[model samples]
Target: MWGEMLGAAIGGVVAVAAAPVVLSAVGFTGSGIAAASIAAKMMSAAAVANGGGVAAGSLVATLQSIGVLGLSTSTNIILGSVGAAIGAAGASEVS
Candidate 1:
């Protein structure tokens, strides 16, 4: 249980941290690019987290027992995207 939580948290943090770099790699730049990058990173993180959960032997049970995590993942994606968009806009403004 604790392991799953830890893994998810780590994954989320990693995704957030890596968003900018990943976006930049994909040719994302300027103000709004940051938001897009963050979104992409979050989506990547969720996919990774889901894979990890399956590997940890809790995928099915986790889904059955607690569905909120899935919702949280969706929320994370949306929020991340918004953030990236904002960043891109900011970057454009600066440029």
Candidate 2:
């Protein structure tokens, strides 16, 4: 529905807007490193989630250890949710 589209748009905007702030706050100067780390962590979480275990905590820990100090608990949940939604949509489209 239109509401979902609006929500997704807002979420995308928030994620885009927050990315730089997060990277700078976490002391990551390289986009490549940030992108790689995030992708790896998200993939790890996906694996864990598929195995019937929640990986959000592990993902958060990994991000925190990598200096993502500005990434709050809510941010982790939002990011994870977004990642999951994207994956599901892609899978459905491919199927």
Candidate 3:
């Protein structure tokens, strides 16, 4: 768990740092997919925190077990895209 989070943090740091320069290039679709991936990761991590483990395919198992983050597809799409765009922009200014 620690390892995974640390890795994410490092990757996120770099991604956030470089994301802005590419946001315009990433465009709507790319940002949307990125957001969805983040949502999935967050939900999976939550599951792991509640009971899941640090085993291989644990996140997949968690997602399969819970059946979506209780959010509708449309909502996910809008939220993810918007969130990703804003997050990337904000992150770029951090460092």
Each model's number of backbone clashes? Answer: 17, 0, 0
Tell me the lDDT of model 3 at 77.
Answer: 56
Candidate 2, 1-95: lDDT as tens digits = 44455555656556646665676554443333344465455555666776944365665445544443445667766775685466555545555
> Per-residue CA lDDT of candidate 3, range 1-95, in tens?
44444444555555444433343233222223234454456545766686864344654443333242333556445545555555555555563
Give the C-alpha lDDT of model 2. Answer: 0.55
Worst 10 residues of 3 by lDDT: 24-33
Residues 40-82, model 1: lDDT tens digits: 4544455677874233344333332222222355655764565
Candidates in order, TM-scores: namely 0.32, 0.32, 0.26
Worst 10 residues of 1 by lDDT: 62-71
Q: Which TM-score value belongs to model 2?
A: 0.32
Off by over 4 Å in 3: 1-69
Candidates 1 and 3: which is better by TM-score?
1
